[model samples]
Target chain A: MKTQKIIDLLDEFLGGERIKRTRREQAVLDLLDKLERKERKLLEKLAEPHDADEIRQLNLKLQVNRAHQEKARQALESWAKTGEAEKSDDGVAI
Target chain B: MPACWKSGHCLATAAAILAGAALVSAAAFDAAFARIAAGAAIFLFGMRFMEDGFAALTGGTLEHLLKRFTTGTLRSLLFGIVTTTLTQSSGLVSVVTISFLSAGLIDLAAGVGIVFGANIGTTTGAWLIAAFGLKVDIAAWAMPMLALGVILVMHPARGARGLGNILAGFGFLFLGISFMKDGFEAFHQAVDLSAVTAHGLSADLLFALLGVVATVVMQSSHATLLLLLAALASGQIGFEGALAVAVGANIGSTATAVIGSLGANIDGKRLAFAHLLFNTVTGGAVLAMLGPAERVVEALSAFIGIVDPTLKLALFHTLFNGLGVALLAPASSRIAALLIRLLPTPQAPGLTPRFLTPAAEAFPEALNQALRLELIRLYDNAVEIMAHGLHLHRRILFGAEPLESVVERNRDVVAIDLDSQYVERVESLSAAIVGAISRADAKPAEQAEILRTFQDACLDIVTAVKETKHLRPNLTLYVHHANADIRIPYNAMRLAVGNGLRAIDQLRKEPAEHRDTLELEALRVRFEQDDREMSGKIEAMIRDGRITPRMGMSLMNDLRYTRSIVRALAGIGRALFGEADATHGAAERVLGLSDDDISRLARGPS
Candidate 1:
């Protein structure tokens, strides 16, 4: 529903900060895949309230992951609105 | 003498002289000796100036090349060869390699690789002298070189000055060789080197020993090389004698490097040892194959259409060094590992000052160097104590663990016992510095004042550590207090003090020339500002029922103590560094706190 140019998408995500990756990282980045995966139970633990130090640590990591996810989503949304794609991790574009 | 002994030839000349000194005219001998001595001095000055010029002209291109090319052992070897060949000084190459290794710019294997190649590179100087100096009318070239050198020296640019020095060095090198050649040729006109040559192991040992002694006395191998080559060219000594002298010269060349490394770190010593080992092993291997090596040289010389024995000796010089590289360079890593075992760490695990030796107290410069080192030691101890007083681990403080997390981890431990650490690490060295300066032989007043200023810096460090002792009790109590009002201010103090310690530790590592004292000044200003803000915060807390009046009073006193501690540390900011330009105290303009800044902080609201 948004009308944006291809250049705007590239500027938002790829200006100044370049990943300069190859096709392998680009493929994973295009699909918005997490870099690594673990048991869903670790994610389940992160939803609980911070009651202990370990819980606090888990909360901190999830906060970092959440921030990363938000950034990635913003980059993808800009690309969807326009014809251009941000530099993917491996530098491939879909 | 090391050169003569190594060559197994110079002793015969000495004996022949002892036999014939009564026959020779005293004036003639004295004149010949004078020319040789003067030539050596000129040659040495030229060599030194040339090195200085090269260093200035290259800027840091040589360093860059060393960094870029020394990625692997083989690459480092080639880079070393090229750098040393261009520089014409193996000692210079060794110094560069050692410095690079110390800076963590290159790995040990790479440094060792360059060193092996440098040994081979030094032989090029011999080639220059033997192939050209012996054959040509050297004075013809020397005059023009000196003329060009003077012209370049007249230029205002630093690069031109450096080029001029290089030209002058070239001129002197040839001129000295010519003088030495004439002196040897003059001696040969009356006497023969043939009378001294014994064809056995004893002859070999004698020449090698002579070479070592001559190098030691002269404190230079290149000078000794010039003398040896001059003798060889004039047939004052035979090929066999030159070979032995070459071996000795290699061994004797290590002395200056070893002496230079006296106050340096284990890495520096290790590099020196590596140099010594390479030369000795190579020299030993050549001695082992001396007869066969000679025949090989003779065959090679015949093949190359060479008639001059001097050129033949130059070929041998190149061959033996190349042989050493061939044999040892492949095992450089093994040699480095062996060196590490040979010269293990001097101290086990704790902080110790290396520069506070008896010799340091013998001269103003040495005393100054020692004092600088002791102050650095004091700084390191202060950092350790200050960092731990904030309940932060030493490793984590300087590690990847975020400073916030490091500061936050002080839930249960107050690990700082300041008095004992001060006694153990600071007091003895501080006392030694004072003692050394007092005993230093008749130092000039300006240098004495500089030492006094460093002594004052040591006092500031001790006082700062003492303040940490007082701050520690409050620091632990207030950091995790139930009251947010008190805890937040206390935590801020911890961060400020911790950051101060980190900055000082960093500045200690940086050279005096490169320090941005303005950044430190800004930080000091911020610390002063923090005191004003902290006082306001404490008053606000008392009004807000966040802390009682009694608690506020205690907090205020502690805050004042915090101010005192920071001021004490900042007090030495200039004194520790201000002594560089001792005569005019010009270093005072750039280093540490000015008197006004120190007084302002001292008189600030507490």
Candidate 2:
């Protein structure tokens, strides 16, 4: 599943239709995939019954991932609005 | 022979005979005068023509040789010697040396070496005249040589014709000498000229002053020396007077360099001072040891078994200069340092207000080096501005409270009016670099690459700063996106910026040696790799639906902009390295990157 997701992202990145996306977007996509996997694992563990310690650990993990995702999402939004997320083939960003 | 020789008639006849002798001698005098004048003209013209032809043939090659081969003082000295010998003019060599110094081709020490060698090379002409003229009776062969020279002048080959003119000039010189000798002989006997026996300086001071005055008028020590030789040969001037004139000639020759450096830069003026100080000190030393030095010359002459005073004088010229160079070579650095101190620093910045001085502009290498330095400075300022913009970007992106100290400092530092002009200047400088790069055909591919990169970097920095300024209301979203981007692609961009700063700084510090081609290539590759990785991350984030469409688009554009800045930085590095080949690859890559990848990277994880 992760491989397929990565392949899809790579395909999308390489596609010529989008005027804005570039190689830098692929890096962000990879990071997002890792975050998603961590989040999915955390949710699966949360569905099971657990002792107080395990429940607390799960919550901590969930909170950390949520923070990471939120940070990533905000950064993405900034990139989107600024149209600066795509690494120009020229390799310069203001 | 006519019967006009008894009593008053005899006396009248004797007077007429004397007058006839004077008339015949006067005609000889005219002939000699004509030959000397013609010879001098041919000599001067030949010197110039030969120098120009040699300069044309070897000017570029010599400059390349100097630039490539001069590694130290010794090599520089040798280079000066070789060039002066080939050109046959110390004055020309000094001018070239000064130009090299002004262009910053050689450091102060090496320049001194070249100056030293040039002084020695100039004496060659004097030796040639003294040695060859004193040998065979050139007068007997002068007519034939002159005729041959004239015939050769009509040759089709310009160079051969020039050589012919030079030979003809030499013949005329000898012919002139022979006539002058006869004219003096006739004048002495026919008229008891009291003016020729006027009392003059037997004192050292007066003799030295005479030497100085003569040299100043002639503007050449060789001419002064030759005149002294002629006077001595005629028995009109004593040896002491001739020697005094020689000393004064040394002092007078320094005027050339001093006048040459009138409005020149600090280095040029310093070099002129070096010339003056060297001559003065050597003259003083020679004066102090005049008795001993003369004895040594006599002894050396005896040892060499040569007997002519003219030859002795020529040897003295060589010996004095040789001694001066030997004594002063070790102390050259100290002398140069003292000159620098005496001149003091100029109150104003910049060497000259004009961009390129006319003297400096003549040499292409010098002009190119100056242009390169200007570009490096411009690139450095651009990097600083970009760094400032990035700092502002970070502040606006994160809702983290602005540091109070920074805010207070900014309040004082950021005079809106002043900064606005500075900002505009920076923008204009970027545009100027672009324009210059576009116009340059010398290194076309390299220049184009540099221009494209510089433009991209300028745009990125401007956009980043402008967006950061506007991110006040959207601080929350901007901060979140920035944090995520910072971990991945932004991290690489930041590193690229750091590397770019280092490269630019290297150029600033040591432009001559720091234009490393390999390192720049490696940096370029790293930038490309980072951009590729960033693209992948951005795509996955969008595919996972972690970020909204609006957020994704924003992320894409911002990261693309960042990469563009990196590309531009890379371009600057390539230009600094003088590599034009990589520009096409950079351009192709820029065209190939897509916007979707940028959007995905900006969106982050689901």
Candidate 3:
């Protein structure tokens, strides 16, 4: 069978939800994954003793990753409940 | 001569000379002249098709081949010979050399070595024509080749089309040689060229000049050589005169390199000059020893069993070019150093456009490459200006020392006229880039997108420079302020911008294959975090009586400008370095966060 036909059959088997996730939602999930990994890494690094400056920058990066993680989680929840893409309020694509 | 040629009127001069020749030829000998002209046209067209076909077939392997193989003088020389022998066009090799040199892929020494090798490599065409084109009924082969070529030309595959074009090109080239041979034979029966042609060195000199004009007009030394070979085979020209014409053709071939380098940087110009120098010196040496050279060619031809005069002419071509390379190859490094000394990069008041040239603008892909190169130049200049404005040295900013230490050490204000610097360094180049973009031809949808991204990047760089200018005055004023609270935030702002610059610099330096857009996007998030922290610090300082209301207001405004500068730099970086690969670019666009996304994220679950 053709790849598209196979994908269609799979989608049908999965109740049409498998391939229907918006790219934005998937992207947000990817971003959340990266942020969470970064947060864990930062926590591990912070566990070791270091100078005050390195500690401060690491903490700042950790806080930023957590903040983005929180927003991505919220966006993911909204998408799940509404089945509609959550739009960025500013509409600026990086 | 190069200066006059680069003044942009050489094309007009060449065209006028060609027009005069055409008028005189037509007025003097009409039908035979038409045959020769048509033959030359077909030959040149064949070369064009072949060049285009090879370019398409090779895609980018030619560049990689040139880059990989052109390591030393001997290697570069061999690469030039092998590639030109395969392509049958020294001009194509020269243009590729210039393009790579302009892009800084290969150094000038390698470029000169390649040029030297190409001189000998181009001689193979003459040999091919003499051995096959003159000895046999080549037009018989041309007919079948053309039929097969047309069949393959209709194929949908690019490789098939490229192969088709190569076959068709050979067919046309063979046909053109046959036509020219027949035309010259008919003309020889009507009137003897030997009778009218001057004798001795004067005749040789005149024929050599004719060779130069023909090659320049046709823009193909192979065409000129094929015509000379046909004339020689038809008894329309003597062997010595034909040798002179070959010498002239070698010299005239440098015109292609000259034109190619017009769009290149100084190293490219140096390479073009080296090409001209090699050909001219060799031509001059050959002419000065024409009698001895002819005797040597004859002796070499007899030894090699080349009984035909056309074959002898081909031997003469190879011998002379080989002689040139043998004499010049050893000194390739010294010649490159000399060229560097002779043509130092001009110290213009402002950074000029290096890659935006009329030659580059002729093709969409070249124009896009040129624009990207020029935009990178603009980005570099803007970075320099912005670094100076922030009272920091670029070397220190882009160094290994911690950003906090770098900012702390570079506390003393550096005096600079930001407006003048902007105008001199950034504005002129920006204007040139915008003008080149506007003048660029309408492109395909994908290329049009690249141009748009380039345009946005240009704007981002200019805006970043302007923001640096706006933030400079207050930075220089209050960076060393008495109040620690005010000074610390300002220092923190410097550290932020510096860290962003350093990170982008590292990313830019990384190879394209290893580039990570996700990392850059994460850096964007990190920058947002820094900006928010600055905002919070300013608010707290104002409320806790650490800083006055006016100071806090100033702090807020400068914080905004700092954020703008940082964002602009990151945007420029992403536009230039982040989109290196299509897959990565698409993924970055899809997954990258926006300002609003970051803002909402900063609100902690809201």
Candidate 4:
């Protein structure tokens, strides 16, 4: 009976501890999960290049992705250099 | 004498009296004209000589001071009064005021105050004539004053020579008035000239019209009024006729400002309109209340214990102007607004653009204010040019930019038809400003720095055009890389240009007590630091294998050119504020940084 009471208490504690995320937060989590899945697929495709045409197509896609990443890196770099990242949401910097 | 012929005899007697009065009136009118002509000649000559002399003596310093200090309305009014008083010609003051307005040196309100003050200052001439010439027997001192004047003219000192010329002019003015007065007296004694029996209002209007025509012809109200005074003194014309002529003279004097503002900017036109408004309004008001005005003059003369009729006329002139000023003082702004509304038009083009005229340079107080506006323009232009460079560079770097075919064709079409004309206009304006500064008595350092800054700006524009010229064919890897590095130099140029512009504006606008040379020095330091950083970055990219040596060299050249451009801009601020030494020290420091050190610094972190 005491063990059963402890299990009930633990269940209540676990339920209380479970995160109650807002809709926006849940959407962000879902997007991350999708991105992780896409990243895995892209890695698989990159490993299994068949013909020259396919390789070329994959290379182009990779180039586009890399360019996007570089842009993000550059934005962060500039922000770090200028200390202007704090005001990014406001679209003004000093 | 016969009883039956009594009616016929009364008619003949009345006709004879009328005929005599007509003859007298004609003679009086002729005498008045002659006296006026003589006085006008003397007045114009005296005024011309005195204006030139004052200008020479002051060496533009007084004008510079006036421009520098008269930023506000009250100060401007006082400046106008003081300057006109010193120069002894309200017309001269008005011309200078118009020039200032044309040059974009002063605003509308300040310009109005100066005009008001000029009117007050002009009264000094009449007072001098009335008080010293009419009141005191100046004959005794005239010869001595003339002799001293000649002696001073021959003196070694230029300033003394100018003063001597002014004194000599004054002597000549008094001498001429005396001669004219004598001529009138002789004419009066020789002929019975009186128009009192004629229809009063008709005669008054005729004389008033004559006064207007005479003053317009001579271009001097003083001369016209002096003639009226001579006519009154000679008993050729009654007080009513003389008063009407005086009123007309006021209207006619405004023609000078109108003529002076012919090709001036909007500000000049506004000023001319203000003068017209003041004179017309005052003259009309006084004429409407002529009866009351005459009584007031008589009462003022009685109160002042002035028994002479000519003295009464002079007192009347003084009282009228004083009362007009008193009434108009509070209404000046409203009057100015109305005048501006009446003559609303853009300033005439190809005439100093109202932004670069020497009007502000004429007064020392307004000079800095004018300079501040100019610096703002310079800053804004630099910012715009830097922004364009950034946009172009970014497009070239990220995008697969098309070759120059269609784009070049379009640019060519725009350039040939529209852009060329606009560019030419700006170029001409810049050239004119340079020419004006060169001709002016500006400090050498200031002149050199401004010219250099303008040249650098022009060169930057040329460089941008040159780079964009062969758009498609020159899309080499090297070219793309060069475009990417353009940002470093462009940003450095922006920092330097902004700092320089701000420094100049602050130097000009800040109060004397708040101005600090160290502040300017610090700005120069920051500009140099940015320039050094840009140079180091280009070198570091090469050292780190991110860029080829050729690419680094090209980037270095651009960075060097940009640094030089920034240095020139800073030089302008330094020149204006008399801080050339600080710029020189900065140049030396930049030179001291070795190539090896610069390369190592450019490498950033290990």
Highest lDDT scorer: 3
State which candidate has the highest DockQ: 3
lDDT tens readout by residue for model 1, B1-606: 122321223333443453354234334566566555555445444544444455344313333455569877788888878887775657656755554554334666777888888877777777877766732355577889889997998898765876787787677666754654454444443323334666677788778777776665544556567778888877778789888887888788777556434433466678778888888888888887788999999999999998888788878888998888888888888887888798864442334567978777776777787888788777777767777666676677676565556676643343233544666677677677667766766443445667677777787787777777777766655666657787777787777676666655566568875543323443455556667777778778889889889778877877766666666565556556533544323223222344455345434435
Worst lDDT run of 10 residues, candidate 2 chain B, spans B409-418
Q: Pick the candidate with the highest TM-score.
A: 3
Which is the better candidate, 2 or 3, if ranked by lDDT? Answer: 3
After superposing candidate 4 on the true structure, give the runs of residues whose Cα lies further than 4 Å from its correct spot: A1-94, B1-64, B67-75, B78-88, B132-199, B345-525, B528-606
Clashes of 4: 22
Error of 1 at B78 (Å): 2.3
Task: Return the TM-score for each candidate structure.
Answer: 0.41, 0.41, 0.44, 0.41
- Lowest lDDT 10-residue stretch of candidate 4 chain B: B409-418
- Residue B135 alpha-carbon offset, candidate 3, angstroms: 11
Better of 2 and 3 by DockQ: 3
Per-residue lDDT tens digits for candidate 2, residues B1-606, read 011210124333333454455456447766534433343333233233323333222213334466545556667667767776664445446655654554344566777877777666655655665676542344676688678777876777644565566456445544543443433332333222111333344354455666666554434555556666666556666555555556766777776566445534567778877777777777777766666777888899999986777677677766777677778766767877877788864442222212334444444334444445555555545544454433332232222343322322221111011123234435555455445444444433333444455455445444433443332112212331324442233334444554544554554455543233223333444444456666677767777766555555655566555555544554455444442223222322332223343333333344
Question: For residues B483-569, what per-residue lDDT tens digits would candidate 4 score against the true structure?
Answer: 455423433343344344445555766764333332333333444455666666777877888766865675556545544544444
Cα-based lDDT for every prediction: 0.63, 0.51, 0.72, 0.51
**Candidate 3 wrong stretches, greater than 4 Å:** A1-94, B1-64, B134-196, B351-606
